[model samples]
Target: MTLTKTFNHVDYLWDDAHATSLGDDQVALFLYRSNILGADLRITNYGGGNTSCKTIEKDPLTGEEVEVMWVKGSGGDIGTLKRSGIAGLYTGRLRALKSVYGGLEDEDRMVGLFQHCIYDLDSKAPSIDTPLHGLLPFKHIDHLHPDALIAVAAAKDSEQVTKDIWGDTMGWVPWQRPGFDLGLQLERCLAENPGIRGIVLGSHGLFTWGDTSYESYINSLEVIEMASEYIEKRVAEQGDKVFGGEKVKSLSPEARKNQAAKLMPLLRGLTSSHARQVGTFQDTDKVLQFINSYDLQRLAPMGTSCPDHFLRTKIQPLVLELDPQEDLSDREVILAKLEGAFAKYREGYHQYYEKHKRANSPAERDPNPVIILYPGVGLFSFAKNKQTSRVASEFYINAINVMRGAEAITEYTSLPRQEAFDIEYWLLEEAKLQRQPKEQPLSRKVALVTGAGGGIGKAIADKLVAEGAVVVLSDINKASLEEAHATYGRDQSTYAVCDVTDMASIEGALDAAALAFGGVDIVVHSAGLAISKPLEDHTEKDWDILQNVLVKGQFQLAQASVETMRKQGTGGDFISIASKNGLVSGPNNVAYGTAKAAQQHMARLLAAELGKDHIRVNTVNPDGVIIGSKIWEGAWAEGRAKAYGITVDELPAHYAKRNLLNEIIRPEDIADGVFACVGVLTKTTGNIINVDGGMATAFVR
Candidate 1:
């Protein structure tokens, strides 16, 4: 979690031979490779990585030597990279080769390759993965699919993971296909972050760079190593057995590679009947157990992970008996299980087609298991022509680990069969739709309610909840916040023990709220205390405290909330708990009335400036509110007792009678009005509705 500069490390190996072509670009090339191998940030994990650099020059045949690039060839360990580690290629030629979609002969492609690479042959063959790196516009680029970084990225809360690790500094991209798609996607990312120095790819890896090679390299290492340490802590917590193991048995990479070839197509055939099934997990024990399951093997009808995973792992595993009698050849068991699995898998596929696929593209392939046998050990995922399978294989591994863990816990509680189908196949809520919820009217909305410890702000929060807005409540009273969110309620709120006078504390509250809620959208400035001191005897500090709660506190909250809301694009709403003092400066309340007046205009100015962003700033100035609110019970009782030299009981009717309505407004009623301004009124901003008993009716229309 603690990521910073200043760490010792092994130096990157850079051979000079690969850099011989560029008389001037030599430093750029060296920096590109050195940064990759030296930093934890660039490589991601120990070796899951990527690399690129800009090329300049034209071929000598045309007497042109403008620019050409040499990227790290695929499958080469970047850590040991030297100047010779790079693979040279002509920029224009490589760009053109990417678009070639012909059954071009090997000899012709070889000739094209030689012509495409404008370099001394000493640089060696270009890396297979260079196409993507070469496609980017930057002078230098690198990628790393690291183990520690991916551990968190692969989890369900990868977004939060990145936030926790990188603070608000790193860019986040959700899981997506790599290669051409990733390159294009990141180009736009770089555009958004014009001088972006690093990228934390969700469910993938991190990328780091600088104007200078050393800067990029150091930053990347600092970031990755920091994240790696964090992940190590997490894996230790989850139990390291879940992360890595030296003794645990695994299918040899070669055996896995071979079995996946046979299994991929077979499983794909079975699960493809409906477009949702993916193949099984890779752990042999779980695969065997699942195959050996009395119920699953007997009745497997549909598929898993997601549809794309279906392409990754195939549809079904091969199936057969572990102990067959007379015909007992190892090969026979494999064949028989495979055959049995295919036939039933086909039947299941057809049934799925009947149930789900009424009219899609005509079913393109037959249903069958790619690999099946007694105690069925599933082959890992792979594609036939593609270099490798990534996501599905990860899925299989994670699933197997989870399944093995769960075997001790009785049963896994996935969604019921019908629910899974609904989620996977629903027309309106499938992957794309579900990935991004339709942005709501208050999509980028947030609110901060002061005095939320008791009544009005709490009521406002209740209403904001209905409108899908998150609220942060602040108060001078810490105990009140705790009591409000007691042991048995829906604890969906955050509280700040803020003293309005202190800038540091107020700023802290605002920052905490933003951090907790992602950002601030609407601020219900409700944290104020009431007092009624006759002007002659009013002391400066007494006046200051009241002003601090009612006026200064609001200013601080708005300042913090506005900054965040602006960045979030939600615009923002600032509503203050202004009394009727601004409209009718009441008796004996000199400091309170003056502060209230300032509070009203503060909102007006904020609204005028922020209105350009569609952020409507507003206020709800209320009077004579009763009920459980702290303002009514505590401050109102004490203030009224001092005002008239009378007890609390007489003050309720005394104040209520002065109003035209002759009825006291409940805290809930005032809360309702405030909520309406924030949630319901899309057009009205900078307006105040009075709630007195018509006491100040001179200007009342």
Candidate 2:
């Protein structure tokens, strides 16, 4: 009820009004209304719902006016939708072709049918709900799984409750898997009830249609608002009451994150053999409130709040027993307990599938829990990417909110297990999950980059992501880390505030990376200091700063990453960013040069020792890499310029001219060299690759 109408994006839809075409107006309205609906998580989630508008288009070949339906394409998010996201299909042709598909059909054949019906020939794959939109006689159609309405729709007395609430203003349909038959049945229901504003499918979602996009969107909003109001009144009538008595106590956020820190990796490792991303909701306010509630243990395992959530988050969450007072430091003990719980959950899922799966159903999916509920800690969601994991977490939170409202009014109910299994394992939904593009070279490879806030480190992180790697960016400055995360795509990359000088901080960062992405396959040690001074003038503190970050910190980072790689039985790469000065020292550069030299030497030693474990170790040395960099903007800039016999502004030119190539090396240059060492030169390990614009003194023989 609190969600207000804020559909002020029509101006954007008409930005290029002078060049607008015949059907452009319809596309604009559809996109605008779709964004408005998608903006509210209560109305729709990540990509759960779909929207469409029917219009007339001219066929290029035949020069004939054709009725077309522009439906939201598969795997498209309406919130950030574009013109290309909506598929234009010949509506009349599709409806006529329905007669061609007569008997039982597998989902794969239906995919071919939908693909062949595209009016625009070049449009993306049409959504599976295309038939639903095509059969309806409305100019515009909207289908959404609004959480509030879903709670009412999932009730055992759904028909009765809906009748009591809206009388005959709404139409009720029984649960039916989305297909041609359901589409036909929906059209028939509309034919039977001439003036109903919307249809509520039991345990599914809401469907509304109108002559215009505005009317359809308004109808959807109004119906959802009505459902929300009904739930509020029922909660009031039930009185403020706690259903179950509280026994388990709540822990502070810090304590809970610490607990999650230890548990997330074990859960990730146990979920699958391949790399996977794991996330926790214990820190989320909604999840914390729900987990600490008295009725959490009782309500969690009953069923999902909505049937459609079965695709994103399974039918029910796997609840784990956690003790706040018990020690969790022993990795072996905690790991064993987690493995036991995972085994039980897997066994249960298999049993459920065995009982419900038909003879011709798709092969049993990987028996892994998507959502895990920890009693005292928080909820954890797992997926292959960060966005999907985040979306799953959001749906579960919405589920909790809906269930809280439903249980307050009446006992919360859900579809039977067999029904849920049918929808979850349906070939149509399976096709949706199987429509991924070709995999990239570094797909699912987890990479950890230190000093990832700017310059060479940031460039390296960006490169890794572009090459299809899940990057964990860590920087000492929290602000820089957050900024980098935003720039590199927040959902694809995660940032960690880590102080490399501290062993505990290094270990925590490694743990966070393993928790965020299953395990580390690549480590880039780029955190270092440039404390330049003569050996006689350098203070103990100055020397310690250089050695701590460059030498000691690098050693700790490698140790932790190697341990994780060894445990995963996956060979990895450890690349340290050394400098040209390490090979040829300048005046008053004793500490900086010595530290860089130590880092390179450490890589060699690690290469020799870790080669037996199939881990490659290498170093990239680059100089004059100051473009778009903060390296030469601090107090050291003046000193470094004076050492090179030039002003701060002239230093870059001075160094650029000194090199044989006479080219100013950029951070990207260093990144490209690192990529070559790791990706191109697989057999060339324990070597120094210099990227200093071909400086003769800095060259390695």
Candidate 3:
């Protein structure tokens, strides 16, 4: 094959002095090029690719310099790699272990050997491809799973394509599951094809090496660029006939969020054993483009874009259809269709696992699908959290792009099912799985919070996040909700603008939470207001305002949340942020106290009704929680201060000193009581926990 020698990143080059002066120059160079390679998505995405450099280090016992290969360590992304990211392994030790390997086909044993071969025992675990890098004589080696390169490598005519493009510049290693055998095959390929600049692993990815790190990195770029150019040329020659360019329609963002709200909880409930959280990628241009494509059904189930993709994405994504002819707004119709599809999908997953699993294999990975593609709506990725779902969604989009390019040149083809299974159940991945940390208290749980724009709502969201829950924030004010998302982190949390007075709004907000995260495990009804007035001065408008938010809105929220929780079959927590005013009243507080008293009673009745469904309902009756709270802002602040016969600035201290504990109650204090209700007080519900620093008059007995 034709190999281009031009270096794309000049900043990565080091002067001869720096390159040679440091005894570990090769390691330094590898780290620099790895970062450059990882920085571009076209080269590699996330932590999919790997790199290494051959160096000589003095053996502690022999006092002689021995060959050592420094490869990318596990769990360390190349984009942010440091010196510690490199695992220094002795080549001789690895080779010595190979003779005694004795054809033992156990992944755990193989992993143990890899760990034992490290030159420094304290160094990180070397990549599973250590043997492949160690066997190669080149000083620098790079292995990348670029999408463009895979388009050529995964083709049925991959051999001929390689011959046509680069001629003798690159060699091919037929598809083999990565392991000790694959590593040996690579060594053989290198020996047979002397002086080759690159090697294409059929159904896998690209590998390049050189005397220096720059040569290897440039070689990788050139080969992938060549493949990309070839694909573009073929597509232009074929015109638009190769793939269908069909227009697909999308629901409005609000409508889509509503649809997801209804269906996501169902998917979460069905796959609750495996997928803890689910997130949608319908808004992204790439995902929408794929789902809307005319040939989506034909191209979607063709399997992963590349073999390495099997690690992050499964062999084939689960595709569910939503009839574009039918109205999507009909919740019952859409949900019935989804339930049927989910059953069939689960059955298929079980069959696939039973077909491929061996006696020694690790328990089949979550039977639930990681990638779910739908026609009317875009794609949804199921994972443990929103961030992970986002990453999986990105990879699925990249796969779609690569498959489109590959199809333009020829029919897009992937590894056979058995090969996909081998990689899916590979030993290396199993070892990585073994290393994952234990789950946190709220791990895989989803929480929905109202009035999350500020005050007690934001604090509750923050506490949920701290406890490992995927929290969805909602508020009537869109700007404040956006600000809370930014403060808590956009990736970790999602937001929906909701007017609690409307049942439709409550449904949409709760649905959005279920859609963003698989299901709602905790529901915090924190949206309410107090309108102070003397009994004689109270008007109908003021009465409606107080009753609508604190009483009616709470009922609607509880109903919608219970419906979702019941469907999930997973017991959940429902917390209402009530006021101490509900239990103890003051003058000119007739309307506010009446509304809260109704709210407190409503919570109690719902708790009794939902208890059979294993749903816990409790109220966090917090008083004097004015710091950073929107409840006491503006006119309300002035009125509350006047009631205490004090200036607005002294209002907070007046309430704090009035409490038995004489302490100021911050918003976070209310949040702590909420956390205790969900986490510490699991068996305690249908009761009120006071958070007013021991308000004797309002204490629940």
Q: Residue 549 of model 2: what lDDT?
A: 90
lDDT of 1 at 202: 55
TM-score of 3: 0.87
Model 3 global lDDT (CA atoms, 0 to 1):
0.78
Q: Which digits, one per residue and each the tens of the lDDT, describe model 3 over residues 213-313?
A: 76787777778878878877886786644457645677766766555656676666766655456555555665766777777878776777575576677
Model 1 worst lDDT run, 10 consecutive residues = 381-390
Q: Would you list the C-alpha lDDT of every candidate in the order shown?
A: 0.54, 0.78, 0.78
Better of 1 and 3 by lDDT: 3
Residue 230 CA error for candidate 1 (Å)? 26
**Which tens-of-lDDT digit does each residue in 506-556 have in candidate 1?**
666665554343345577887776767778878998788877777777777
**How does model 2 fare in lDDT?**
0.78
- Across 1-701, the per-residue lDDT of candidate 2 in tens digits comes to 12235332111222223323334588788887788778878888888788999889898879999998999988888877788888999888778766777644543466578876788876868876778888888888899988777877777678887787789998888877677767777888899988998888877788998787767877777788778878777766755353343456667877777767666666766765444444544457657666767788777777784655867888888888767655766767877787788889889989998999998789887788889877667788887666777788888887886776667556677778887888888777777778877766666567899999887889998888887777889989888888889986656788788888888888888778756665677899987667655568789898888999999989999998887776555577999999998999689898888899999999999999999888999999988776765566575677788777788888779878989989998888888887887777878779999998888877678
- Measured by TM-score, the strongest candidate is 3
Q: Between prediction 1 and prediction 2, which has the larger TM-score?
A: 2
Ranking by lDDT: 3, 2, 1
